[model samples]
Target: MVRRRHTGRRLRSDESGFTLAELLVAMMIISGVLLGLMAVQTSALVTTAQTRQRAQGTAVANQVMEQMRALPWASLSKGMHASFASAAGGDPNVTSSQLHPVADPSITEPLVTSTDQTTDRAPLSGAGGSNKTVEADPSIPGFTYTSRAYVTRSAQTAANVLTLTVITSWRANQTTTQKHVILRSQAFAPTGGCGDASNQPYLGACQALLSGDAGATGPTVTVAAAGAGPTGPVTTPTTPIIPGTEATVATLSVGTAGVGLTSQQATAVEATATHGGLQTLTADAAVAAVATGGGRLTNSASNDAGSAGAAPANPADVTGVGSASPLTVSGTGMSLQLVPASGTSANLRATTTVSCATGVPAGQACAASDLTGGGASSVVLTTGGTPFTVASVAGGGSAKTLGARFTSAAGTTAVGCAALSGPGCLGTSVKRTVGLTSVGQGPWTGGAAPSGLASVTSYTDATLVERGLSQRTTAGVTTRTGTVSYWNGSGYSTLTIDRLTSTTLVTPAVTTTVGGVTVSASATVTVTPAMSIASHPDPVGCSGQGCSVTSDTGTLTLTVTYVVTSGGIPSAFTAAASVGSGRASAAFKAAPSA
Candidate 1:
């Protein structure tokens, strides 16, 4: 039983808790392990924060570098300062101030600020203090960042190398850390004796070189001089080079193996030596003395009659010598004349020889044969009406004949007119025969009529009369006097009838009595008789030959005498008549045989 108990106890003890020292030892070991893990986590968090701070600092440094690069190179020179504000939510109470270089280091230093110090202290907020706040906001705390840039010059012995160093610093997480970046650049500087120092427009790099700075170097250069001595040690004398001048002068050594100055600098040195001679020098006068040529000049003045001298007849000819006693001169006068020789003739004659086959007349029709006179001696018509004298005659031909009625002027006659048919006169006073009365009249009935005339009862009469008498009546007789008298107690008859003659037949009468009661009438007659008729034969009836013959019809015109009569007396008769159709009858009269 005891052994069973012991076994049970052993088992119990095997499953039971440890002793005090053993538990203490285990607790110590666990504590060491937890402590080591906590340390590792803490270190990781701090390293991450530091890395973040370093990245922010690098960003700030880049911003500064960009700003400097963007500025004009002149503004980036020494003693130039600038201020910048932080971005939003980015240290509102802090500011950065730049400290521009003024001396050899040629550096720019930037300072950052803290919020509390910058807001509370006015004097401490100036650019000299890094805590100065460019933008102040109460809600957020701010910290300042600062940077400084330094130029590293090349070694005086080396001409091709340049170096620069930049240092950036910031405060974060209660600690200050810094970053440094280095840059190197290179360029060529002018060498040889040909460089002119005065010709160097940009003096920054050169000045830096001469002053032993050698930072941010530029292009190369050489030196030359207008008048330079041979290689030797040259000494500047104590006495003034140009007397009585206050200008400062110096002598510089130029050698074959050592440093030398540019040509422009040598010129300046020489000019400085000479400038000591003059007290007050004018550039214009000095330049003018060396220039060439003077300009042409003239002068004019107006004069009046009463001003100073007497007036002359011609202003242009008012010379010192009088015109009446003109001075003898070799040149010819203005109005010289020369006459031609006395026996020389002034006329000029031109003869043009023409070949003619025949002689032609003036104003006459001509043919090609008329122009075939071969070499006839015809005188040419002159423009001035001077007769042309024929010098000689040769190769004469027969003269062409002209019209009989044509003639020419006396000098040397030529044909003037041509024989050609023209208009001719038909002759005056063409007479035409016409019958005065018709032979057969209508059958007369119960009326007294002449033997050969019929008592035409159906005759229509158109009569007209002029009541003036050509003769004047006196006592009981009619006389050829100008005055006309009416019958009163003067024994002059009121009515009288005379036998009708051609002159007394003014009141042409047509008498036709129906029952013989003296039906006598007078008429102003317009007589038109047919002088000629133009005939056209009509086609025969449509039958064989020997059918009834058709008469030829024609147009007839009449020429008749018209008389104006009045008061049963003759007055005047007109030679021409106004006659038309139906005023008389269209009697068919047989045409006369040809």
Candidate 2:
């Protein structure tokens, strides 16, 4: 039993041997390792979340900015607000007021939309909220997010350049994490470049800044250098005279009294109004002296003038011969009668004479004579003589005169005529007369001779006319005939009868017979009067009222009577006529006078 008890004690000691300190130490080590692992995981998760949040926030910010940029820049400064829903949320009902950050407070109240009303509430207090948050609201049932954006003007220049910052915050594993993103943006006035007055200085600064060494820091300003001004003119040096050249001088003089030294001597003379001190000389006196020494003078005189001689006068006399005298002769009756021609068988003769008041020239003489029968009938004469000739003649029969012709050496021609026998038949005469007459009616008989009538005449005996009409008519017809006579100078020659008809009259059908056969015939006739207007006013004067007949007695109608005879017997008769109104037409000048 004692051995059993000891064994028990050993077992109990083995079971209770591990102390509390050792146990506590082992627990501390395990806890530290686990805490370290947790910390590492937390840090990694926070970094990843921050990066993700930052990326998301940056994307959201870029989207919002793109939208705002699309709007006119003027709208931004007017405090216009725009709502941007997170893309992660399908619905635009959920919102976050912390979409803008605190760093640049210019963006006061940016808008946000979300599905959960609680998520859409402001994340912080006041106008805009901070960009931080814990777990996503369970009410939203989606990842919760906080975002903030801010805008700031660049201090470098007055130009409308803005820097935008977006911060996103959210809870991850019960720890808050924040991410930051930045972007640059700009708003422009309507004018393309910035309108700020201070931009000029800023531009200079920017140029200097760009040219500075890498990593340079400080204000940049450039200064310009200065310049200089102007002066006067330079004087001319005197020219030196060369040696060994001859100098020649000339002087002239005039004999006139008041001619002093003239401007002609300006190169040689040196005259002054006051010389040395006291005396003064007149310009005239000086000029006079110069003129006298220069020998320049003038003299005047008077004389008479006469007209130039006239051309020689034309001669008063000339020597030449004049034209010869013409021959003259006269006679009466058909036969030539002359005292010198008593013995001549043919009494007609031609004579020519020549004379010279101025004696003939030494080598020339005049001669003239008459030409007789044979080939010498033509006369040829010499200067200072006379010539004559007798020509054979023939008389004109029947009391008509013959013509005599004479020709001169110079080709002058003349002709003469004898007397005529009958009165009014001296030269030539012609007469004509016309007469008109009617002849008795008769059948035209053709003959070789003209029947001694102007036109053919027709004659009809009462019985023969009736028989002719009956022969021309049909059977069982009775006939009648008429006769008319006209005197044609040689007693009562014959009579011509014509049937007249009124063409204007409307006719009626009449039956007649011819050659034992029945025949039908009709006639229409009209007669227009040849009337005269003795005295009537112009038609225009009576245009409204009908014209008045000035001479009614002169107006006459031509009556045309129509007779219908059957079987050579008169059956019915009608008359139609027309007369012109005694009215004158409006006078239109037939021809205009020049």
Candidate 3:
């Protein structure tokens, strides 16, 4: 078969092989195909390495962001992880302006700044370690990466929101461009920018607290010491502090005091002892007392003393100290002065009885056992070796009061309210008797009349008069009044005066002819406006323990003039007096003797 195939196929020499140019072209084509494959593989390898590095860089950025997120509002500042290591939250009393790291208090807006990177170390593993730069690492296996994190406060999102950004950079090769991976996140500050109250008084903000529920928490709130008064620092837990039921939030030491708490809802405020300390509460029932009697949180030592001067022989007509004749008076005069022998601040006392609530049964009344006394009576004041007895009342919810009844040194004549009640001293009618002396006497006319008795005179004489001490208990308040008067033959000349209400009295000038003598008199009085205190709940926040009472404020003032014209001559006497103003607060301590 082989011999037969050879005999049939005889070819020319030209067809057996190719030309040299063609051969060269074929070789070139093969070489190009192989090179293309090699190039594609190389490109793929490079791409994979780049993707891995990017993932690592992104992870580093994420780590930095998380670190910043864990920090509190106060600690997450320009510093990195260890720069501001404090765990303290924002101080409520300290505003952002006051607390910023920089001295610029006006910087209210947030600024974007690079975090401190000096203390941070690269987390990547490399033989060159900390000493190598990304560009210096050969083979790119030891490429060093650098990370930077920036924090910015974004008001557009929220006042307390912070935007965190992290950028991780590295170089693929010595001549390659820098590549970076960025990651962003956000964190929120506590509501109201408040932190734990244990730090300091931050009541200015974060005043409201979260309700008391299981697993519930809120920022700490503090009551700071400020102003002139008995003041002490008070800090409370995050939970709501039930006044009286819980521990005291603050204590005012004996000699110190605190200013009013601004803008608080019904909250309990307290003072340990009485002194000149005054704690005024601002806002609706914001300043409340935990003491039993709705008493003020203050203290004082001196009683209401008239403008410094000597008292008349029978001042205020309360003490029957003057002689029988109005012309020549010599005896111990009425002195409205109280000096506590022990020099203690235990002066005023009170007792309260609440009425039936609005929704109580029609026939049922409040019980006597419901009486709540401010304190047991003690020695409050003494004058002329005789201590004045304080008066007590019952069954006045808010108008109940304690007062003193003045009597002569011999205990003969007395001037003052008989008893204290919500309706005022119900059974008492205060009367002042003044014995006046005849001035500029006129000769008796031939018949039944004195000479010059019909003449009239006018004068606006200004003179300092003796302070008259008068106490009137009306509508649960005890007002001390000073009156100007002169001694008459038998008693004070009766004058026309009207008391329209507990707060108003009308006294008009008058001229009268009695027994051939013309006498003209005029009197003036000043009263401070009544304090309109709103009704509030006991123990604050409607704790339902009982109702609370309000304290009272009062002033004393009076002016009087009396003139007599006889025998065409005129003699005038004027009296002007003012007693110091005082306030009566609820008493929770021992009451002085009544």
- Per lDDT, the best of the predicted structures is 3
Q: How close is candidate 1 to the true structure, as a TM-score?
A: 0.21
Can you give the lDDT of residue 158 in candidate 1?
Answer: 53
Tens-place lDDT digits, model 1, residues 1-594: 355434433456577778899999999999999999999999998888777766665665565454433322222222121222322122222223433332223444343223322221111223432222222112225754554432223445254222222335555555554333222222232342113243132222221110000000000001011111233123133222122222112111000000000111110000000000001121233322111111111111111223454222112211110011111111111110111001111111111111111233322111111101112111111111122110111211111111111112110122211222111000000001111211111112333122212110111111100000110010111111111112122222222211111121122233332322212222222222222111212112111111111111111211111111122222111111111111100011111110
The per-residue C-alpha lDDT of model 2 at residue 526 equals: 28
**Alpha-carbon TM-score of each model against the true structure:** 0.21, 0.19, 0.24
TM-score, model 3 to reference: 0.24
> Can you write out model 2's per-residue Cα lDDT over 252-279, one digit (the tens) per residue?
1000011001010000100001000001
lDDT for each candidate structure: 0.21, 0.22, 0.28
The weakest ten consecutive residues by lDDT in model 2 span: 208-217
Model 3, span 1-594: residue lDDT tens: 455435566688977888899999999999999999999999998888888777766766677566555433444433232221221122121243222222233324344432333332222111212211122233366676765544556556776566665556777643477776666676554444543343222321222211100000000111211111123123234211211122222111111111111011111111112221112122224445332111223211111133244222111111111011001111121111111111112222111111112211222111110111111111111222332211111111111111211111111112123332221111111111111111112221222112111111110010000001121211223322223222232223322222211332324444545444454444444445323222233222222121212222333233344444444344333333222222222211110110
Best-fitting candidate, measured by TM-score? 3
TM-score ranking from best candidate downward: 3, 1, 2
Stretches of candidate 2 above 4 Å error? 1-28, 72-101, 104-155, 159-182, 189-594
Ranking by lDDT: 3, 2, 1
